[model samples]
Target chain A: MEFLRTLPNNLLIYIIIAHTLFGIGLYDMMFRKTLIGMLISLELMLQGVGINIMSFGTFLNPEPLTARVITLFLVGICAAEAALFLGIAVAVFRNYQTVAFDKLTELRG
Target chain B: MSFETMVVNIYVLSFGILLIQVITGGLIAVLSKSLVHCFIGLVIALIGVAGIYYYLGSPLVAAMQIMIYIGAVCVAIAFGLSLTRKAGEEGLKSPGPRAAIPPTVTLVMLLATLKGLSDRGWINVPHKINEAPVGHMLLREYLLPFEVISILLTIAVIGAVSVALIRGRT
Candidate 1:
C-alpha cells in the first residue's frame, strides 16, 4: 500500500509508461494502413519521448531549462511536421484517390 | 488513516487514473478502425499526457501540449481527413498477421532492453537545481533555437499551403 502511494513519485514508473506508449505507437505505425493513422502513431511516439525527457529532467537533472526548452521545441517541431505531412497526405490522396500506403506505388523502384 | 495519508492516497489514485486514460486512449487510437475514433483517442491521450506533465512539475509544458496537440494539430488533422476522405468512409484496412510480427518483436525487444537498463542504479546527482523561468531561458540562452524554430514553423505553414494548392491545381 505504501509502495502504491509512492509509485507516482518514482522515475522508473514514468519510464515504463513512456516506453509502453512508444511501443503502442510503434505497433500502430507498422500496422495502420492509412497515412493519417501513421501520423497519429507518430504523435503518440513523440508524446512518449516528451514524457521520458521530462521525467528524466524532473528526477535527475540539476538544470531544469534543458528539458523544458527541448519539450517546447519538440512541440513546435511536431506541429510543423504534422502540417507538412498532412499537406503531403492531401497531395497524395489527390494524386492516388486513396491514402492507403500500399496503393501509392507509382514511385516504387 | 491520517490526513497526510489520505492526501497521498488520492494523489496516487489520480495518477493511476491518468495512467489508465493514457494507455486506454493509446490503445483506442491504435486499435480503432475509424479515423475519427482514432482522433478522439488521440485527444484523450493528449489530455492525460497534460495531466502527467503537471504531475512532473512542468505545468507550462502541459498547457503547451494541450494547446498545440489537442487544439492546433488535432483540428488540422481533422481538416485533412475530411478533405481527403469520402463522405461515407467506414474504416481502414487492418494489417495481416505476418505484418504484425515485426512490431510485436520490436516492442518486446525495446521493453526488455529498457528494463535491463533500469535495473542498473541511476544516480540522482545532488546539486542546486536552477528554477529559472522558461521564458527567461528561451529568450536568453535558447534564443537562436527559438528563432530558428519560429522560422521553421512559418516555412512549414507556407509550404503546406503551396503544396496542397499545387496538387489541387494539377
Candidate 2:
C-alpha cells in the first residue's frame, strides 16, 4: 500500500516508535516487582523520550535548542532518580535484610 | 514508483517489525517471572528503541543510546537482578501496572483523540530561523544547565560505584 510505503519514509514513523517505547517502558516501570527491573524500564523510557525530542527537532520543526535542552533535563532527572532510588534500596536492604518491593513496608507506618 | 521507493518500503517493513519487537520486548520484560528473561527483553526493547532513533535522523545519538543505555544501564540492572532470587517465592510477582482508568477505556479515549487530531489541521511555522547543530544551538543558551548535568552524571557514577562496593562487603 502507498500509505504503508510512505509511513516508513516519513519521520513520523520514528516518532510513533519513540512514543510506544515510552509507554511500554513506563508501564513496566510501574508494574515490575524488582527495583532493578523498574530502574531498567525507567531508563528505557527516558531514552525513548530523548529520541522523541531529537526526532521532533530535526524532522518536524528543526529547533535544536528546544529538543537538546529537554534532553539535558531528562539526563538530569534520570541521574537524580537513580541516585535516590539506589540510596533508598540500600537503606531498605540494611533495615529489612531484603530489598524486595513488598518487604519495603517502612512507609506503612 | 521506482527502486528507491522499494528500498524505502523495505525499511518501513523493518521499522514495523522493530516496533512490534519493542512493544513485545517491553511487555515481556515487565511480565516475565525470570529476572534473566526480563533482562533479555529489556535489551531487545533497547535495541529496538535504538533502531527507531536511527530512523529519526541522528545515528550518533541512537548509537549512544545503545552504548549508554543498553550496554551500561542494562548491565547494571543485571547485577541487581542477579542479587534477587526467584520473585514468586518472595511474593514479588509484578504489581500488574495500575491504571486510574482501565486500559480498555484508555484505549478508547486515545482512539477518539487520534480521530480528532487527524481531522483538525495544524499549521507549521512559516520561517526556519534557527537550524543549528544541537551543541551550538543549545550550549550557548543553556550553559549552566548543561554544566549541572555533567556534574550530576559524575555524582551518579560515583554513587552507583559506592553502592555496589558497599553491598560487596556482605
Candidate 3:
C-alpha cells in the first residue's frame, strides 16, 4: 500500500503510456493487413511517444526546452512519415491494384 | 482497511483497467484481421494513452494529445484508408515471410536495448523546471520550429495533392 503511493506515480504512468503507444505502432507494422492501417497504428504510437516527451519536459526536466522540442520534431517526422507511406501506398496500389499488403508481390519472381 | 482505503483501491483498479485498454488496444491495432478493426483499436489505445498522459501532469499536452493525435491523426488516416481502397479488404499480398524476420527481430532487439538503457539511467531528468503552457512554449522559445512545422505541413499537403493528381494517369 505504502509502496504503491510512493512509487513515483507520474513516472510509472508516463512510461507505460509511451511504451504502449510504441508497442501499438510496432504491432501494426508486424501484422496489420493494409499499409495505411499499419501507418495509422504507427501514428498512434508516435503520439504516445510525443505525450511522454512533453510530460517529461513539463514535469521531470521542468525547465529545459528539450523534450518539447523533441515532441515537435516527432510531430514533424510523423507527418513526413505519413506522407511517404501514403505515397508508397498509392504507388503500390497503382502497380499492384490492391492495398491488402499480403498479395502484392512483384519482385518475388 | 477503511472505507477511504476501499475507494482508493477502486480508483487504482480503474487505473489498471485503463492500462489494460492501452495494451490491448495496441495489440488489436496490430493483430486485428481487418483495417477498420485496426483503426478502432488505434482509437481505443489513443484514448487510453491520453488518460495516462493526464496522470503524468500535463493536462495541456493531454488535451492536445487527444485533439491532434486521436482526433486529427486518426481521422486523417481513416480518410486515407477510405480514400485508398475498400476498408474490409486484405489487399495485396505482403512482401511476405522473408520480409518478416528483420522487422520482428529489430523490434525485439530495440525494445530490449531500450529497456537496458533505461535501467542504466543515461539521462536523468532534473528535479523541477518551468512548466509553461503550449502557447507560451511555442510563441517564445519554440517559435521557429512551430513555423517550420507549418511549412512542413504545407509541403506535405502539396506533396499529397500532387501525388493524388498524378495517380489518375498521365
Candidate 4:
C-alpha cells in the first residue's frame, strides 16, 4: 500500500508495461491468422513504443518539448501508415476475396 | 498524510488503474477471436495510453492520442474490417511448437536487456513539465520536419485514394 504512492512516478514501471505490451503484440502478430488482427497487434506495439517515449521524456529529459514534438510526428506517421495499410488491405480483399493469412500465400515459392 | 503525500497517492491510484486497463485491453485485442472485439480492445488500450500521456504531463499529446488514434486510425481500421469478407473456416490456429519458440525467446531477451540497463543506472535523469516550450520549438527548431510531415501526409492521402480507386475500377 505504501508503495502505491510511488508507482506513478517510477520510470521502470512504464518501461515494464511498454515492454510487456510489445511482447503481447509480437505474440499476436505471430499467432493471428487475419490481416486485421495483425494490424491491431501492430498498433498495440506502436502504442507501447509511444508509452516508452513519453515516459522517457517525462522522467529523463531536461527538455520535454523534443519528446512531445516527436510524439506528434509519430501520431501523424501512424495515421498515414494506417490509412495506407487499410487501403492496401481493402485492395487485397477485393482481389483475393479473403483476409486470412494462410490464404494469402500467392507468392510463396 | 501531508498534502504532497495525498497528491502522490492520487496519482498512483489513477496510474495503477490505467495500467491495468492498458494491459487488459492489449490482452483482449491480441487474444480475441472476433475482429470487432479486437478493435474494441485496441480502443480501450489506446485510451489507457492517453491517460498515461496525461500522467506524463502532456495534456496536448493525450488529447491528440484520443483524436488521432481513437478517432482516425481505429475508425479507418473498422472501415477496413467491414470491407473484408467473413472470417475463414480455419479460425486462428494455435501456435505450433516451433512457432511458440521465437516470441518467448524475444520476450526473455527484451526483459533481460531492460533489466540489465536499469541495473546499470543508465536511465536516470531529472525532468520537468514544460508544454509551452513544445509549441515554441515546433515552429522554430522542428519547422522543417514538421513541414515535411505535412507534405508526407498529403501524399499518403492521395496515394490511399488513388490505390482504392484503381483497385475498384479493376
Candidate 5:
C-alpha cells in the first residue's frame, strides 16, 4: 500500500503512462476509418509526447522552463493543426458526402 | 497514521484517479462509434493530461493544455462533426483479418518496451526551478518563435477558411 502511494513520484510510472497513451493512440490511428478519428488519435499521440517531454524535463533536467515553453508551443501547434484538419475534413465531406476511408479510395491505382 | 502520511496518501489517490481518467477517456475516444462521444472522451483525456501537467509542477502548461485542447480544439472538432452528415458511423465496410494486425503489433511492441523500460534506473537531478516567469521568457528569449507561432496561427485560420470555402461555389 505504501509502495502504491509512492507510484506517482516515480519516473518509471510517468514513462509507462505516457507510453501507454502513445500505444493506444498508435493503435487507434491505424484502426480508425475516418479522418476525424485519425485526428483524435493524433491528438492523443501528441498528448503522450507532451507528457513524456514534461516528465523528463521535471525529473531529469536542471531547468524546467524549456519544457514548459515547448509544451506551450505544442499546444499552439495542436490548435492550429486541429483547425486545419477539421477544415479539410469538412471540405472533403462537402465534396464526397462521406469521409469513410474505404469509400474515398479515388487515388487508388 | 501520521498527518503528513495521510496528506500524501490523498495526493496519491487523486493522481491515481487522474491516471484512470486519462486511460479510460482515451479508450472511449477510440472505441466509440459516435463522433460526439469521441470528442467528449478526448476532452476528458485532455483534462487528465492537464492535471498530470500540474502534478509535474507547471501550472502554466497545465492551464494552456486546458485552454487550447478543451476550449479551442474540441469545439472546432465539434463544429466539424456537426457540419458533416452521419458522424456516428464506424466505417461502412467490414474490417477483415488485415485490420486486426496493426493494433496487435502495437500491443506486442508496447509490452516488450515496457518490460525493457520498467527495470531501468534514471538518475534524477535536483530540480533547478526557473528563475524567470514563463511570460518574461516568452517575451524575451522566446520572442521570435512566439511571434512566429502567432503568425502561423493567423495564417492557418485564414487558410482553413479559404480551403473550406473554395469548392463551395462549384
Candidate 6:
C-alpha cells in the first residue's frame, strides 16, 4: 500500500498521535485522585508536546538541528520538573500522611 | 516484491506496531489503578516515543528520552512511591462518567482540526537529516540556554534535596 509507506514518514500522523497523547494526559490529569497519578499525566502531556516539536523540526524546519537542540533542552527541563515535583510530593506525603488530591485541604482557608 | 518495496513494508509495519504500543502504554499509564503499574506504563510509553524519535531521524534524542525518562524520572518516581508507602497502597480514584466526555471531545476536535489543515495543503514539508549541525548549534547559538539549563539543573537538585530533607527531619 502506497499510503502505508507514507504514513510512517508523514507529519500528520505524528501530529495526530501527539494530540491523542495530549488528550489522554488531560483526561488522566482531571480524573486521577493521587498526586503521583497527576504527575504521571503531566509527563504524558509533556511527551506529547515533545513529539509535536520533534515532528515539526523533522518535517517543516529549514534548520534541522534547531528542533533537536530545543528537544534536548526540553528533556533537561522535564527532568528538573519531575525531580522537583517528586520532592514536593514526598514532602506533602510526609506532612499530610496522604497523597490524595481531595485530602489535601490544609490551605483551603 | 522488489527489495525497496519490502523494506518500505517492513518500515511501515514496525511503525504501525510502535504507534499502537505508544497508544496502549499511554492508556495504561493514565488509567491504571496502581501507581507502580502506572509507572510501568509510562516507561513503556516513553520507550515507544523513543522509537518514534529514532524513526524521525534523531537517534540522539531517542537515547536521551530513554535515559532521562525511563532511567531517571521513572526511577525517581518509584523512589518517591517507596518512600510514601501509604500513598502507593491506596488505589487511585476514578474521575467518573463525566471524565470520559472531555477527552473524547478533545480527540475529535483535534482530528477535525488536523484534517482541515491537511485539506488546506499545509501538512507535508520536505525533510533532511543533518546530524552535525546539532552539536554546532548547541555550542554556538544555543550556548546561553545550554549553560542556563545546567544552572537550573543544579538549583533543582539543591532545592529538591532541601525540600525533601526539611520535612523528612521531623
* Chain A fold similarity by TM-score, each prediction: 0.95, 0.75, 0.78, 0.95, 0.94, 0.97
| TM of chain B vs. native, candidate 2 | 0.72
**Residue-wise C-alpha lDDT for candidate 5, range B29-104, written one tens digit per residue:** 8787776787788888999999998788777788888888888898888888778756455632344676676567
lDDT of 1 by residue, A1-109 (tens): 8788677778877887888888888878887778888899899999999998888777767676688899999999999999999999888778778888777787799
DockQ of each: 0.60, 0.38, 0.35, 0.63, 0.59, 0.63
Supply candidate 4's per-residue lDDT for B34: 83
**For model 6, what is the C-alpha lDDT against the true structure?**
0.83
Query: How high is each candidate's TM-score?
Result: 0.89, 0.76, 0.74, 0.90, 0.88, 0.91
TM-score of chain B of each: 0.82, 0.72, 0.72, 0.82, 0.79, 0.83
lDDT of model 2, residue B89:
34
User: lDDT scores for all predictions?
Assistant: 0.83, 0.63, 0.65, 0.81, 0.81, 0.83
Q: Is candidate 2 or candidate 4 better by lDDT?
A: 4
Arranged by lDDT, best first: 6, 1, 4, 5, 3, 2
Docking class of 1: medium
- lDDT score, residue B108, model 1? 80
Q: Looking at model 6 chain A, which ten-residue stretch has the lowest summed lDDT?
A: A56-65
Ten contiguous residues minimizing lDDT sum, candidate 3 chain B: B120-129
DockQ of 4: 0.63
Residue B33 C-alpha lDDT in model 3: 68
lDDT of 2 at A20: 64
Number of the top-ranking candidate, with TM-score as the measure: 6
lDDT of 3 by residue, A1-108 (tens): 776643335454555556656655665566567778768767766766676676556554635456745665676667666775676777667766777765766557
* True lDDT of residue B62, candidate 6: 90
Expressed as tens digits, the lDDT of each residue in B5-94 for candidate 1 is 888788889999999999999999988888889888988899999999878877788889999998999999999878877543435455
Ranking by TM-score: 6, 4, 1, 5, 2, 3
TM-score between candidate 1 and the true structure: 0.89
Clashing pairs in 4: none
Model 4 TM-score (2 dp): 0.90
Tens digit of per-residue lDDT, candidate 4, span A1-109: 7666656667778888888888788887888887778888899989888988877776666666678899999999989888888877777777878888888888999
